[model samples]
Target: MPRQAKSAAAEVRSLREEIERHNYLYYVLDRPEIPDSEYDAKMRRLQKLEAAHPQLADPASPTQRVGAAPREGFGKVLHSVPMLSLDNAMSREETAEFEARIRRFLNHTGPIAYVAEHKLDGVAVELVYEKGLFVQGSTRGDGTTGEDVTANLRTIRSVPLRLRAARSRGLPERLEIRGEVILSKRGFAQVNAQQVERGEPEFMNPRNATGGSLRQLDSRVTASRPIEMFCHSSASLEGLHVSTHWEFLDLCRGLGLRTDRANRRCASLDEVFAYYEATEAKREELPHEIDGVVVKVDSLELQRRLGERDRSPRWAIAWKFKPRQAATRVLDIWPSVGRTGVITPIAALEPRNIGGVTVSNASLHNMDEVERKDIRIGDEVLVERAGDVIPYVLRSFPEKRTGKERKFHMPSACPRCGGRVRREPGEVYYRCLNVACPTKLEGGIKHFAGKHAMDIDGLGDKLVHQLVETGLVKDLAGLYHLELDALVDLERMGEKSARNLLARIERSKQTTLDRLLNGLSIRHVGEATAKALADHFGDIEKVLAAEPDDLLEIRDVGPEVARAIAEFFAEPRNRQQVRRLLDAGVRPAWQPRRGGKLAGKRFLFTGGLAAMSRHEAQARVERLGGAVATSVSKNVDFVVAGEEAGSKLKKARDLGIEMLSEQRFLDLVGDA
Candidate 1:
C-alpha cells in the first residue's frame, strides 16, 4: 500500500473503534461518554475519509451505518437453521403444564435450571458475522426463508458490526445470533410525534413502528429511527463453546452483543413464576415493551434431549401476561372522509385512560368491522391498546346495549359535502365520487401549487387549509384574488411571508400551458399528457377549442386521455374557473414544436440566481421551445450556474457543457 493509503487505513480503524465504543456506551450501556455533537463530528469525518478512499471501505466500519441508495426490493435469505417460534402459556396452569411436559420429555424428576427473559414486543431478526465482522442480517420471515435486511439492521447502533475480542479466546469464524429489534415506549412516542408533524400516519404501536422501520427500502430511513436490539439466542456459534443458555448470553455480551439485564437464571419452576410476577408488576416501568416472559431450560444438553416439536422448541415457552384491556362506552360513531375519498367510521369514546394514554377515538376501519364487533353508540365495549397506540374496541357487550343504543350506517350523502357516496364493486370502502367535495377540493388545491404544477412557492398544505377554512378562498380562482390583509390574518402568516407568497403567485401568472393544464388536476391528465396537449395546441384558446378528435390525433393521447380532456373542458364550472383565471392576469402560452426559437436546447441550473427564481427561468426556457434538465451532463447544451454554484458547476465545466451566468443566460434567451 502507498504511505497515504496506509495512514488512511489506520485512521479508519481508529475511528471505527471509537465509534463502536461510543455506540456501546450510549445504546447498550445507557451511558454516553462523549457529547452528541462531538460524536457527530467524528462520524462526519469518518464518512468523508471513507468517501475519499473507496478501497478502504468496509461494511463493518461505523461510517457505513447511515445507509445507502434505496433498493427496488429486498432479496430473500434462507436461514441455515430455521428460526423457530415459541408456544405460549397464558396462565399459571398453562405454564405449569408446559413445565410438566418439559419434565416428561427430559425424564428428569430433579429441579431443572431455567433461563427466564422478557418476551419483547418486537420483530425477530438473525444477524450473521463471518470472522467476527458483521456480514449479513435478515428478518425472521416464515422461519426458513427471510427478507435480507442487512443494510437496515446495520443502521441500528446496538447491533455489533465487529465483535469485541475476548481475553481468553479467538473470535468465531462464523456466528449467527438471533435477537429482537425493539423501540422503547419513549422512542415510539417520539416517532409518532414526528409523524404527526410531517402529516404522515402514526404507527399503532412500538412493534408496528419497529416493523415499519425495519422494512424501509431506504436504509437511511431506518438509520433515523430510535431502534435497538437484544440478542437472546444463537443459531450458529462456530469456534465458541458454552454449556448453558445463560452462559451463551454472557458470551454474547462479552462479544459486544447487547443482552438484557432484566433476565434471570431460575433453578426451579417456583423461581421462574416469581420472576414472571415481579416482571409483570413492573412492566410499565420497564424501558421497553414486553408482553410475556420466555422461560427456557438452561442446560443445552437437556434442550437437545427435549428437542423441537413442529415450529417450537419443547424446552422453551412464552408465559404471557393477561392482555391489558379496559372497558369504555362508545359515545358516538361518525364517518370521516379521507384524502382518497374513502369514508371510514371513527368512534368517539367516553374519555377513559388505557395503557397510560387517554383514549378518545378509534377507527372502526369500515362498516364491516363495526358490524362484526357489533359496536354501537351507548354500548359498553372492551378496548385494547397495544403498546399505547389508540385503543380499539375488542368487543361490545351486547347484553348491556340499551334500546337507546344506535347502530351506525354508512350515509348515502357525503358528510363533508352533500354529494352521493356509493360503494364500488370489489372494494369494501364507500367513496364520494364528487370532485367538488371540500375534502377532495383541499387535496386538489395542494396538487395545484405543487412543484410539477404551478411551481408556486410558499403555498403549502397548512396555508391552503387556512385559506379554505377562513372562507377567503373557495376555488382555484380564489387564490389569485387573495387579499394581503386576508392572508396576513391567517394562522402563522406574517405580513412579510404573505407578501412573498403574493409575489410568487404573481410570478406564476406567466407559466407555460403545460404547467397551467397540470395545475387544473383534470382526471386522467398528468404531466406527460399536459405537455403533449401544450405542444399540440401552444395556447389556452386553441386547447379549449380542440375537440376530442383533435386530441386523439396527438401522440400518447389515447381514448381515455381524450375523454378526460373533453369532460374537463365541457364542464361549465371548470370553464368558468378557467375564464376567471384568465381575467386575473394568468396567461398560459407555449411555442409549437415546428417553430425555431430555442428548440433542441437543454438547460440545467444550479444555485441561487439574482434575476429570477429557478422555476421561472426554466419556464422561460420551455416557452421558447427549450428543454430543462435537473442534472449536469455532456448532453446538456447549457449549464446556467449562478452565485454559490456547487459540484454541478464544476462537473458541467469539466464535461465541456457551455456554462452561462445569469446575465449570459438572460442575453441568450432575449431576457424574456
Candidate 2:
C-alpha cells in the first residue's frame, strides 16, 4: 500500500474509534462527554476519508450507519426462533387469572419475580449481530418469516453498528435481539408535517410512520426520517447464559444497545399491578407511545418450566390499558365547506364521554370514508380518539341499527351557496368550484385573520359574519379596506370597538410574506409550505410568476402542490384580489433575509422548547435567514434539541448532523 493510503487508513480507524466511544456514551450510558457538534465533525472526517478511499470502508464502521445504496426490494429472511405475539389481559380480573394460570403451570405457590416493561406501540423486528457486529435486521412478518430491512435499520442511531468491545466480554458469538421500531411523538409530528408540506396525506400515528419508514426501498429516505428502536428481548442467543430477564436486559444495555429505562422488577402480582397503574397514569407523558405493559417471569428457569402455549408464552401476559372509545348514536350527517372548497362530511353524534372528554361530533373525513364505513344517521357507532386525539368513527354497529336509520348521500350542490359541487377525477373529495361561495369566503376570511396568520384581533366569527352578511367584505382584500363608519353600523359594534379593530387591521399590513401566502388559503399550501415558498421566492410577485416546474424545484413541493400553487396564481379573480389588497396598504414585507449569521442553514427542533413554542422557534430561525426542516436529513445543518428531545436527536447523531442545546442555539442566534 502507498504511504498516503496507509495514513488515510490510520486516520479512519482513529476517527471510528472516537465516534464509537461517543455513541456508546450517548446511546447506552446517556452520558455524553463531548458536544454533539464535535462528535459530528469527527464522524464527518471519517466518512470523507472512507468516501475518498473505498477500500478503507468497512460494513461495521460507524460511518456506514447511513448513506447506503437503494435496493430494488427486500428479500425474505426466516427467524431462527419465531417472534411470537403475546396474550392480553384486558382487566385486573384477567390479570389475576393470568397469574394463577402461570403459577399452576410452574407448579409453584410462592410469588414469582416479574419484569414489567411498557409495551411499545410499534412494529416488531429482529436484529442479528455476529461477533458483536450488526449484520442483518428483519421485520416480524407472520411471526415466522420476514422481509430483510437491514439497510433501513442501520439508519436508526439507537441500534448499535458494533457492540462496545470493553463491555462485550461475555457477549454471544451470534445474537438475535428482538425489539420494537418506533417513531417518537415528536418525530411522528415532524414526519406528518413534512408529508403535509409535500402535499401528501398525513400518517395516522407514530406506529404507522415507523412501519412506513422501515419499508422504504431507499435507505437514504429512511435515513432522512427520525426512526428509533428499543431492544427488549432476545430471539436467539449463542455462547451466553442468563438466569433472569432483568439480567438479560442489563447485558443488552452493556452491549451498547438501548433498553427502556422504565423496566422494573416486581416482587409480586400486587407490585405488578401497582407498576401498571403508575405507568398507565403517565402514558401520555412518554416520548414514544405505548398501549400497555408486558409482565414476564423474571426467572428464565421458571419461564422454561411454564413453557409456551401455541403462540404466546404461558409465563408472560400483556396487561393492556382501557380502550379510549365509547358507543354513541349518529344524530345526523352534514356537509361542511372548507377554505379549499372541499366538502367534508361531519357526523353530529349523541354527546358521549370518551377518555374523559365529551365528543359531540366527529369528522367522517370524506364521502368515500362515510360510504366505506357504512355510517348512517340514527345508527349506533363506535367512536374513538384515533391516536388519543382527533375523534374518529371507527365503525358502525349495523346489528343495532333501528328502522329510523337513514343512508347518507353526497350533496350534488353546495349546501351553503347553492353552487354546483364536483369531484375531481381520480380524487375522493367533492369540491365547490364557485370561488364566491359564501361558506368558502367566510372560511378564507376567518383563516386570514386567524392567530397564526395576520392575527387581526377582535375580528372573530360574529364580526366576520356581520361583515359578509352586510355585504361590506367580500374577500380577504375587503378586510384591509373596511371603514370605521361601516363597521359601526354592524350589531354590537360601538365606536371604540370599531376603532380598535381598524387599528389591528392597519397593523396587519406590514406582515411577512409567509403569513400573507398562508392567509390566501391556497390548496395544499399550509404554513410550512407557505414558509418554504416565501423563503425560496423571497417575494409574492416572484412566487406568482413562477411556473409549476419552477415551484417544483423547491424542497417538499411535489407535482400536486406545484399544480395547486400555479393554478391559484393563474386565477384572474385571485390575482385581482391580491392586487387590491396590495393597493389597500397590505404590503407583504420581503426584505432580503438571506444575509444573517445563520444564512443558508437548516434546523430541526424536537421536544419542548421552554422559552417558546415550536412555531415561535421556527419563526426565529426564519427571521435569522435559516430554514426550519420538518425532518432530519443530510442537508440539515443543525438540530436544536430541547428538553426530552427524542428520535430526531438520535437520527442527527447517526447522520453526523450537528446538534445544539437550546441555550447554544439561542447563543448562535444572538438571543442569549
Candidate 3:
C-alpha cells in the first residue's frame, strides 16, 4: 500500500510549518495549544516521512531543532554545546525498539546500562557558573542560542549564587547545568488565588506559569513567583571528573545543586521499563508535574559511540506515559476539507481541561470512525490527547445522551466551494470532485510549485492563494500566463518580488519528468512512484500511454497505484491540461536509471571528500540503481571515508565492514 503521505516534498513542508507553529506556541509563548503527545505525533510523522524521502529534509524543519527561537525581549546567549531534545517512546515496545536500534547502530551484543530520570514537565533552562559563582542563565531557546534570563533565574532562591564547598569534588573552572524550573502544586494554587484577588487572569497550568514567570522582563516580579529548579542533564562539565551520567548527577548533588530524587540507574532495558511503570504509577504524588521518565545510556563512552541525530540524541529517549482523558459535550459536528479534497469530520466540544491544557475540538477522522465510536452532537464524549499530540474522540456516551442528540451525516457537497462530493469504491475518504474548488485548487497549486515538484522558489501559500482568488490563475497551466503588472499590484508583492516570482515560474518549466508527474496532483502518485515511472518509461509520452498492467511491470508500483495512474491519464480534462502545459513550453527533462555495477549496492559516506561534495556522491550513486543511506547499518554495503572520518568510520570498522578511501570511492563510481 502507498504511504498516506503524498507529494513527500510538499507534505514535508506543510508538516514542518505545522510542527513549528506548535513549537512556538508551546516553547516560546508558553501557551501550549496542544498536548505533548499531539506535538510528538506530528514530529514523529514528519521524521518518518522525511526519512523515507531524505531529499525532502530541510535544515529549518522542526525535526532539525530542539525548540523554537527565544522570545525576543531579552539578550541572547550562545551555548558551548547544542542542547538537543530527547525523542519519546510511548510504550515499552517502542522503548525496546529504541534499544534495538542502538544495538544495530553500535553492533553491540553486551548489556547496556542506563540512567532513568523523571522527565519533568516544566521549563528547561541552562545555567552557567564561572569559578564557583553563577555567571549566566537562559532558556533552552532553539537549542543553541537562548534568551538571557540570568537576572530572573537568579531571583529564584533555589538557584545557587555560589557553589557550596566540597572536599571530594571541587567546582570546575566553568560548569553548565541544565535543569527544569517548576512551580509546585501548592504554589500554583496560591498564585491563582492571588490572581483572583488581584482581578487578573489565572494561569492554565504550573508549567505555563513557571515559564511565563521565568521570562518576565522584571526580575522582581519573577522573584515573587514561588518556583524552584531541579538540576537534570548538562551538555558541558568543563573540568569535572565525571565518566557517566550517574556520576554527574551525584557530583551535581554534592555541589549543593538539587537533583530529582526519583532518578534511578538501570542496568538493562527491563530495569528501565520497571522504573518507568513505577514512576508513572506515583507521578501524581510528586510535588511538581512529571509526564515521563528519561532514559539515557549511563556510559559516557557508549553515548559518544551512539552519537546523535540532527534534532535529538540517539542514546537517550523520553518514555512518556499514556494520554490523559476528559469528558466533554460535543456541541457540533462539521466536515472540514483538506488541500487534497478529502473531507474530515471534526467535533466542536464544550471546552474542557485535559492534562493541564484546554481542548475545544477533536477530530472524528471520517464517517466510519464516527459510526464505529457512535459519536454524535450533544453526546458527552471521552476525548484524549492521543500520544499527547492530537485531540481524539475515543468514544461517545450514548447512555448519557439526551433524546436531543443527533446522528451526523456527511454533507453531499464540499463545505468550501459547495461542490459535489463523492467517495470512491473501497475508500474511507470522501473527496470534492470539482477541479475549481478554491481550497482544492490552491492545494493543487501548492503541490505543483512545491520544492518536491516544479521547485518554484518564490511561490508561497499567500501568493498562491492570491493568484487563485484574484482569478489570475485557475489551473496549473494558468500560472505560466501570469504577468508582472498584475502580480506587482497584489498585496505585499513589490515590483522586485513580482519579477522574482515570474523568474521562478519560468525556471519551473525546466523540471524533470518525475517531478512533473508528482506535481500533477494524481490521486496516489507521490515522488517515489513518479520517479519509478519516469525511470522505467523514460519519457512523459510513454507514461501517458502506459496501461495499468504496464505500470504494474515497474518495481514498487502496486495495482491500486497503477490503476490510479491509468485513471488519471484517462481523464480528458487532465490530458488537455498536459497539452496546455506542453504548448506553454514546459519541457520536463527525462532521465533513465542506468543498470550497472552499482545497481544493488548501498553507500554511506563519512568525513570530508576532496574530489567532490557528499551530495555529488549521492547523485553519482543514484544515477545507477544504487542507494545512499544516512547511517551505518547491516544494510550499508560500503563505507566511504575521507580526511578525518568520525565515529561512523570507527563503527563501520568495528563491524568489520568494508571501507573505501576517497580515491577508491571515486574510482568505483567512475568505473560504473
Q: Model 1, 1-672: lDDT tens per residue?
A: 899879988998898889999988876667899999899878877876787789988878887788777999999999999999999999989989998998787777988999999999999999999998998999999999999999999999899899987558668778999999999999998776555323345676799899999999999879878899999999999997889999998888778889998889999999998999999989878888899999999999898899899989999999988887789899999998865576879899988877668888887777777898889988998888775456677889999866999999899999988789998776667888787677766767777888988888787878877777777878888889988988888888889999999999898898888999988877656677788777656678766766676667565676866887898899899998889989999988675564437755667889898988786687578667766666665446789889999999888888888888899999987855
lDDT of 2 at 617: 78
User: Measured by TM-score, how close is model 2 to the native structure?
Assistant: 0.75
Alpha-carbon runs more than 4 Å astray in model 3: 1-264, 267-322, 350-360, 387-389, 398-405, 457-463, 489-496, 591-672
Which 10 consecutive residues of model 3 have the lowest summed lDDT?
63-72
TM-score of each prediction: 0.60, 0.75, 0.44
Q: lDDT (CA) for every model shown?
A: 0.84, 0.84, 0.79
Sort all candidates by TM-score, best to worst: 2, 1, 3
Flag clash pairs in model 1.
none
Q: Write the per-residue lDDT of candidate 2 for residues 1-672, one digit (tens) a residue.
A: 999899999998888888888887887778899998799779767866787789986887887777477789999999999889999999989999998888676678987899999999999999999988899999999999999999999888888988764354666889999999999888888886666444344565788889999999988778878888899999777878789999999989888898989999999999999999999999877888898999999999898788788988888899988888899999999998876677878999999988778999988877778888999999999998745445889999999976889999888999888899998877767889787997788888988998777888887878887898888998888888789889898899999999999999999999988899988888778787888787766667766666566676576786877898899899999998889989998878765564555655668888888887786577577667766767776656789899999998998999998888988888777761
Model 2 misplacement above 4 A: 1-74, 151-157, 160-172, 184-213, 216-227, 239-241, 436-438, 441-472, 488-501, 517-535, 545-581, 586-672
TM-score-wise, the better of 1 and 2 is: 2
lDDT of 1 at 161: 90
